[model samples]
Target: MSVSLDPVNIADKLSLIDELWTQRKIAGLNDYEIKLAKLKGEFVWHTHPETDELFVVVSGRLTIRLREGDVVLGPGELYVVPRGVEHCPVAEEETAVMLVEPVGTLNTGDTGGPMTRAAEPL
Candidate 1:
């Protein structure tokens, strides 16, 4: 049997825990997944060696610092960081974001350290 779902309030479904960043799995499309994330402060600089990451700002603002430059995104804005491009995401305030990427893509990407951990499936 096939399972399906109705339209969901993505932001409302995210669990706000003690972690500086929280993510909820929204849905999966073939080999890709859509996730909702609530973030604050800065994330480690990393890169996905073989997958691109699509970020859609839901609320507040996010700045993606890249080697070449930085991209600032506001609500309803979207940006895609190509594979192998190093980036660090920063949110001066609490920000809600939606991410679309391949299912196996790690939140920490290529770099691994204290700041890196496999994304917990929600």
Candidate 2:
């Protein structure tokens, strides 16, 4: 097996998106992966049945909508969406975020929609 990782600029990995968030994987360990995403709009409501997801805002604003309420995040802020809790992520404009989740954890979680995808290295 081989493993490699390096320092990342974070912002430099975000890709331009016209409609939805674009995620770029930056690093991974034995059980988890780090991914950066450029978000500009709302994502579907979903949940991770197996693991929690951690999101750290790198820039712009982001909101995680839940049945109880919503957790809003901004630059330099972070939030953890507990496993199996249905939620939706929304961004008013271009927002950069770093996500840490279990390896192979689907981006769309329990909902395998068109946006569902395996993370790709930046």
Candidate 3:
């Protein structure tokens, strides 16, 4: 069977998510999460063991640092970091970004850095 969902106002929801910097489960079956993250400065290097992370720049530029090199994603650009890879996200200026990931995935993985466990939107 197929299901249809009512249109949601992502902008409005973004406000709430941004306030909390938490993950919101969009589709349970698919383990999809929609999150709004505000970044300034640099983040801890980390990795996810079981899920790839999708990051879309919503307002400003974001830089992802990997062991190999760094990639900069601009507004409207999306990038995916494969699982089991070490990466760190950074922004010189305040940046707003949308993230998609599987349920229960940690913002920081094996690194267990300071930002490893953060609050999530229920």
Q: Which candidate is the best by TM-score?
A: 1
Encode model 1's per-residue lDDT on 32-105: one tens digit a residue. 88888888999999999999899999889999999999999999999999999999999999888999988877
RMSD of each: 1.7, 2.3, 2.7
Q: Write the per-residue lDDT of candidate 2 for residues 23-112, one digit (tens) a residue.
A: 667887768899888888899999999999999998899999999999999999999998999999999987888999988888899899
Off by over 4 Å in 3: 1-6, 17-29
Candidate with more favorable, higher lDDT: 2 or 3: 2
| TM-scores vs. true structure, each candidate | 0.89, 0.88, 0.80
| Candidate 3 lDDT over residue span 41-111, tens digit each | 88888889888889998887899999999999999999999998899998998777778876677777777
Ranking of models by lDDT: 2, 1, 3
Off by over 4 Å in 1: 15-18
Please estimate how well model 3 matches the true structure, expressed as its whole-model Cα lDDT. Answer: 0.75
Candidate 2 structure, TM-score to reference: 0.88
> If both were scored by TM-score, which would come out higher, candidate 1 or candidate 3?
1
Extract clashing residue pairs from model 3.
none
* Backbone clashes under 3 angstroms, per model: 0, 0, 0
